[model samples]
Target: MSEAPLAARPPAQQDPLPAAWPDHLRALPALIEAAGLVSFDFFDTLFIRPLADAEDAFDILGESRGIADFRARRRAAQAGAFRVMQQEKRGEIDLDGIYRCFDGLPDAAAVRDAEYALEQEITLPNPEMIAVFRAALAQGKPVVVTSDMYLRAPWFTALMRRHGLPEVPLFISADRDCTKRDFGALFDLLSAETGVPKERILHIGDNAASDIGKARERGLVAFHYREPRLPPRCKGISPAASLARALIRNHQQEVPPGSLRELGFQKGGPAALGFLDWIAGAARRDGIEHILFVSRDGHILRRMAEQVRPEALPPSSYLLGSRVAFTLAAMTPANFESHLPFLLSGADGLSPAELLARIDVPAPGASVLRDLGLGPETRFRHDQPEPMRGLLKAWRWEILKIARRNRRGLLRHLLELGLRPGQRVALVDVGWNGTTQEAFVAALRGLMPLDVTGYYFCLADSEDARRRRALMPMESLVGPDSVSPGMLAAIHANRVAAEFFFSAPHDPVIGYRDDAGGVVAVEDPGRAPTDGIQAMARELEEGMLDFARHHTGWTRRLGLRADPLGLAMPLLEEMADGSWADHSGLRLVRNFDSWASSANHTMWLTDYAARP
Candidate 1:
């Protein structure tokens, strides 16, 4: 294949040209002028890893090949190989020699070959450093590349050529049988062979001890390359997470303004990826039989899961679910008080009729309120539990009839949907209080003996969720002690964004319907998405899935098993109420009546929105 010119390539993929010397290298030009020979460290300085660690190569190999603990095994093999080579007084340890120590291994050659392929695939050329290298050559100074890696000299040469590195001398440890660390070993050979005095040679690399300290001791001037990395955008982020943000920044260069794909790729993708991986691992660990991603948030989640979920993890199915469907279906006249907290979520300090209307009450509604001795506009506050309980009592029969009908249909829906009695299942959702999970529990009570667990993206009011811990096995990505209070706050503050991004482009489910062939989710047409929100949602979901697939591809190719949640925080934080991001399309998203209860009023996520 022919190479695309950097100028014509997407900004994200284009490397910096020779004119790209920045502040860090302001001193380099003078150093290059003074030196007769410029020696660059090959791995960190020239070839770079998108992954966080070198051992990750072994981990990826193990996962792909189905080998157990290959990282540890590979490390042990290298150590053993080095020790044996030292005892034998052979030259420096090399790749072939290391594999020889991997005893009793079938397809050792394949493993070795796979590792080599991974090493090459994972490493990319450092654009800025490549520019510095070209500048050194342009100045007519002799140059060479040095590396202490165990790969073959020819392989290294080919890698250099492919990356457009000048075909200069190589002082590789495996090839030269001496390393830069071996007290004056490779340096002595380099100085003598190149006929450049040690005082006039300049060495540059990332390792402070080896590249700077050791080289200066050998009478060569050294520059600690200090290879650049994106800083942690949020607290407790990993290097891999930081790199994820860097990847997004690179991606945004070409992305259009208000691109839903960028938003999903930046925030939603990582969130789903992390949450899905966490739940998949948890399901596998807990021996879960199947996972039901509760709708409509699960609409996007179910699609993203296939990209990152472990094969050993149980299969997943999407449950046509909603707060209204689950909560209302599971309600009873006697337990109306039990479900009052959820039903009255949008009714704090509001009219009693407001709650009834949200739950869809019919005949005698206005007149029934009068007969019950409570007017239509009667005030009800969250603090007035007594009044609320009294109101629920007056309308118990009317509500119970609807609840029972909803319950019957919802139960039939589940049974027809392939979930039966006695199955170990997990309920996955973009969570707050594990409400749907609990509702599923209540709806299935007496009908089925299924074991159900709940996995949420986050938990709100952790203390409240903890209070119900005795009732169900529930887990969250950002909840309780798992994350700092600050992170939890950020997550809570951005609930609207979370809901908007993950929500399916459909109406909210009020209950299930028994159609001729199967049970279909009955949606509240009143709560249906507007054409604008629906269109944006479709694009958002498309972008989110796009990100999932691209992320899977990039991470797998680089042998990085990324922390999806930690990596997601940077973009999520930027999208928060007050951050650097413009939040153009996001600002147009309407705030929801929590759980689709109460009045379905729409409020734009603009100045009226809450802030952290």
Candidate 2:
């Protein structure tokens, strides 16, 4: 019988230090200071073991005679035993107890040799991870290690300590025989030990069900540790990133800007009513006899106006208990302003003093210098003497005040044209949906009651038509094919008896055509609606209603369905007796146009230029 000799093995190659560590990661002290507590995980997440030998290696090697050769077999045996132990874990066997049981085995050296051999083959620290923990320590971040293992506390602690992570706090489920996945156990332990708010505690681990997901579900921000050997499905799909993004989205939702309720308007019906009250109060305070509220979309406003009961009326001109005397006239701002001078002139006769007398107003204050009448051009300099200067200043102020009053009176006279309570008024808008309609309705409802006895018809686009399909089933259902801008306008004029309309301006069915004869379509996805004025006005006129008053005259509130200024300029030009200038208020409100129409012309030119 012959004995075999041992072969010499080459020295192991050492890993080189990384050229440069990430500075951001290196500056973890600030983060640690910010974070009250830090936590970690163990096992495959923090440490990974190498490949194993056959299933029965350990038992086979246990029968080997010599220690040197047995060492190699022991390594193989250790891996086999670890595999068996892991498999036993699934079958309800305690891995730690198994390891301890092996500790008490008869061939202790063989087992020890097996463990050492396995350790040499498989065990190593993850370098980047080493950097992370070390950086955290430098930043004064307290470390806590949590694991869902069936290992003894002493053994786990000893294992981590051996792996350069001893300073970190260790919270092992098996240590207390309480798993981290058990929410009550983890919550109780975290609350009792850390005394930190549950929200402040961040649990980082690999398992979604047991670690990050459960922790996050309990209002804690969970940080899932990504490991390299993870399957592609698991990569970057941790609940941590999802939770963070969801939190941001939720925050954004909670603080959405420009909502009517957020703007101090009451929610629902009360908001509509309150808006009317606000508008009335503002009109009264401003002494504005004629208040024109032009909307590109006027559905809700028109509804409210039509629905006003007599009891909702404010009594005195601009003052009664619940009623206000201010007349509500809605047209495109351009049209309104064009006729503004005449309207103001008409309102010149509306005496603020008369209105004040109707309501109970306190007496005016007495003048200190009563009889000094000065000319309009009388001047006073800053360098004038005190007493005489004061008198001259007073006289000068009186003259200036009178001039200003007269100027305002002229403006009022011009603006007061056809301005009277109980006068025929209309609110024009661009679209049927959104806040503008809501706001206009509230304002109008405050003024006059509506007539619901009239017939109802809706001139809508494909989108709106689709939404209203259930209501208009038997009617000629026009899809994209039959619907056009002129067709929709005609529909509003002929079918709805709509006094006011609201619709999208860029909607091809209602949008304005420019000078070179091009319809304004939103071809550029990059562009946003600058303003909805003309569009709103056009929608109000075209999409909303066709009104036939007792006078046998048809009035349409046409929204320019363009930008406010864009819509305004064209209406102004049209008012000057040009080709588009046709202001017969009895038939149509105004033509809404756009400054941005040129962009459409440019696109047309570019198209022609690019032709083959």
Candidate 3:
């Protein structure tokens, strides 16, 4: 049956013409009141798939389970199914039909199940269109869903009810085995079922061609609700109901929200929540009693925990520490060789005087290096270790003597900062090989004989990690080598981005000294960070804290737990792929020196692309 030839009623006299694009959705309620019947497109109208595209669900289903190039394969399967359906004169292909045409049918059923789950996960209620849906019902107009979608009636109705959408008649093209392309056959069926003429019906949807043009073809007044543009890094992954959205919406309510704050709220905050949740769970599983948030990366993390510690999480302390601080304080005549690499890491192209200063070798002790046939101005690179190592070794004792004195002061500082003899502690940082943990352990050798576990954001999976794994327990929140490897690898290649995210607003802790008999941080008198970086840092900090506060309230309200990691994966994937290089806040992260390597921040995205 085809729609009867009819002329659509003009828009309501009380309501002005609907605005263009995004504003059209908001103006839809007035149009609904003008009609005897209101038709809504199922997807991207009443609800949305908060993914890059409708097909992105297939990629998520396949990639999340480590199926390589699953999206490409899934796309091929769907195209093949469509071709088969065309030959058979079939309607929109259902999920099962697409899978039946799938290559490697052995895994088809499993992947299909995953596809259903991912669809369920990514689906979101379009709040503005939902308002239109409510208005239609409120006007006593007959409301119905008309769509050319694969999802059948039962599941579609189920989804509507699940999201609090009122029960109404649905006219699905797939159910009738006729699509919108069938010249209003689907709309005629809707008119027949609802007993409302096509001319008096008002339709609202996202697609201009399928929803607007087709409804107009059916003599129904159509309103186009165009999707809004997402933020720079948020493209392809911004879920409408996510914490990132919540933060963005909240920030927009403020007088003005900067990109820096939005970055933390949308990207860093969710990532941090995911990592923190993982860390807390791991710590509890390992029976850890106390967690140490090692400086300077842990500053924001520590504050987040303080603001929102999940129920019964282990006690935490913001431990004042760094690789150079712990390594220099722990180094002795016997272990100076082992600590030498960290000392000379960024010291390659400088004179002995500059190198001595870089390595934290004190004034008088560094002067002892001149006696070993190497003047204060002698240039030696650590990479060519043969001559430089020999010269450094010739006077290692004197340099270490000064280092040993600092070690005593550090022990006192650590004690004052709350390290004890036998505490079951864990060291936390934005991770890689657990070098800080190793140095921290060595620093406490005489003072605490403590065997502390290391909890990193991502373990480097290197020789150092393997060696340290034998010495003490270790766990990583993110896996570059294992779980979520693709996303994590993108994250790894852009590790500089993570450093940029967690950059702090304070000078780094260089060393410790006695202050009125109590140990205090002996920070450098000239504490210089990249100019303008701290403004971004403070904004990121505020945004992250804001997320933590809201996250606590939301999880508590929902009762059924939301996946923090799931919220983070989308933003992180963009980061891994270098999409965040455009963020203005990240650009301020210059000369970011971490893990003893210094480089321009956010430049790694280009550098990584050039590799191989």
Candidate 4:
């Protein structure tokens, strides 16, 4: 076919080119119009396989052919063949040449046929470039294809025709025994055979060195069709990770500006928006009237919700409260004994007055401590003595008094929100055992009648959470069920980073108090320090927002809303697993919680590298 001049042949009638070209081929039309003849590089330039990489096709071949070792053998043989070809300076090797490298393999013909079948199954025409080819034909410009592949010219032409390309002159390195990579021999051969002036031919392909560089050396115009380049760290990973990286790259390419996908690139952006999206849907489904975001994790969540879907979601407010404050405010004499261990867990090495100060309760006077048979300088430990327990038991009434006073302050705060009795109000929070919600319910028991539901990103399957029928758990991509326990632990280890990212700039809630005027929330003294934590938090927030903005439109167009949970799982899993190497740079935070008294006394989260 190459013996005849492509320019001498008549152009074939074809359908008009697509009005909108794919991103990579947008420049092809102009390049084609400028040249009298155009040549396309086959393989990636005009076709792309859906597989993660080209060699993945061999794996499919091995599975289909029932030859478990075929893929490995094929790779070894190809590497050996390429070494021989490079040594010989022949520039290329055909299928037979490659097969000859595997001298010990039985039934070479069968193996070759299996590979051909696999290629047929995996090869797909790149529509964007095909449109460019068709456009060249319509514009009466002669066209041909040149490839560096080891496949024979006939097989290449046949595959092209099967994929809807019109028959045209073809030049392959294997058939010619010379490559475009060596001295531009293939281009010289094409010019000699097709009788087309090298200066008048334009070559368009993905490889800069072989196609563009070689063609340009031969005085032909070259258009580089750029493809996404994965970072060096992303390549050569496990297949699952490689595939994940490819999927991420594809998502980035398809994502529109200001969509969820774009926003998600910001740290903590996707999780925040995803949780809010789930909350909005839940509120709509359950007929919730008011949404209260529990501080301080809910602080950022509320802000994100307002920015992303203000109109679609119900009215929301940031309620100033936390687990520690609410748990203390809701304590009663009846439950005080059962909760004593938890309340005093963080009070190790503290004196009676200091211990009382920690919970923001008034410390009993020295005379009262002495009367209760306790010294002012007495220290508390994880395992309290019987005397200390008795002393705690005696102080229950005072604790209850303080709890009731704080409860009144909480009730007054809620009343100011103007929520009607029996209204369905949903409390939003970052998940765990739902202790804050439980405390809130206990505090408001007789003060007000309201149907309150707790909505969280994930609800821990703890005894406390199991009994709460009013708690609504939103399935998260990075929860226990979605990932292995080890992975879940890894995420928990990063809680400090997560919390820092999700937290607002304001101080933490201490407790509430009531005066003659009204209820007031007491906040911590100063802002959380700005350090590496803040930098990481900013990254997470920006990443999530960017991903949300970028991918939201694509998600809608692709009908991804049908299984939003499934769609979100992989991305979340990758992030949770720290699959991307860039995630290694995330600041590792060490969190020490004295409240946890399990056998594994010091819980480790984040800093997987530093884990003992």
Please list the C-alpha lDDT of all candidates, in the order they appear: 0.70, 0.34, 0.65, 0.64
- Two-way lDDT contest, 1 vs 2, winner: 1
RMSD of each: 8.4, 28.4, 9.0, 12.6
Off by over 4 Å in 2: 1-34, 50-96, 99-121, 229-612
lDDT of 4 by residue, 121-196 (tens): 5566665567677788878888888988878887776687687677778888988888888778999998888788
lDDT of 3 by residue, 1-612 (tens): 233222233322332322441443566656766788888887866777534356645544554567767777878888988998899987677778888988775667877876665666556666656655665555556677788877677767667668765667777876787777557677767777667778877877777787878778988788887655333333343222243444443234331344677677767887777777777878878888888888778888888887787463687888776776787788887777886666566554455544555444543345556555566555666657555566557658767765776687777765766667787888888877777888888788776776599888776645777788788788776664445656655666667667666656765665666678676654431212345656767888787777767765645533324454565564566566787776655655653453332221222223332111
TM-score of each: 0.62, 0.26, 0.63, 0.53
- lDDT measured at residue 187 in model 4 versus the true structure, 0 to 100: 94
Q: Which is the leading candidate under lDDT? A: 1
Backbone clashes for every candidate come to 0, 69, 1, 40
- What ranking emerges by TM-score with the best candidate at the front? 3, 1, 4, 2
* lDDT computed for candidate 2: 0.34
The lowest-lDDT stretch of 10 consecutive residues in candidate 3 is 596-605
Clashing pairs in 1: none
Q: Model 1, 1-612: lDDT tens per residue?
A: 222121211222234334546667778888988998888998768767654455655766786787877877888999999999899986688899999999677899999998888777767776677767777766667788877778867877777767766467778888888878767477777888888899999999888777788888989989988654523234334434644554543243334436776777666777777777788778878889888888788888777766544463577888886778777787876677777677666565456755665565553466767766667657666776666667777777887777777787877877766787888898888878777787778878766778998888878766667776767898877776666777576667667667777788776677765678877776654432443766778887877776667666776655565575676565456545445224777666653333333333555645333466
**Candidate 1: Cα lDDT at 421:** 82
Tell me the TM-score of model 1.
Answer: 0.62
Q: lDDT by residue for model 2 over 46-69, one digit each (tens)?
A: 554311212222322333333334
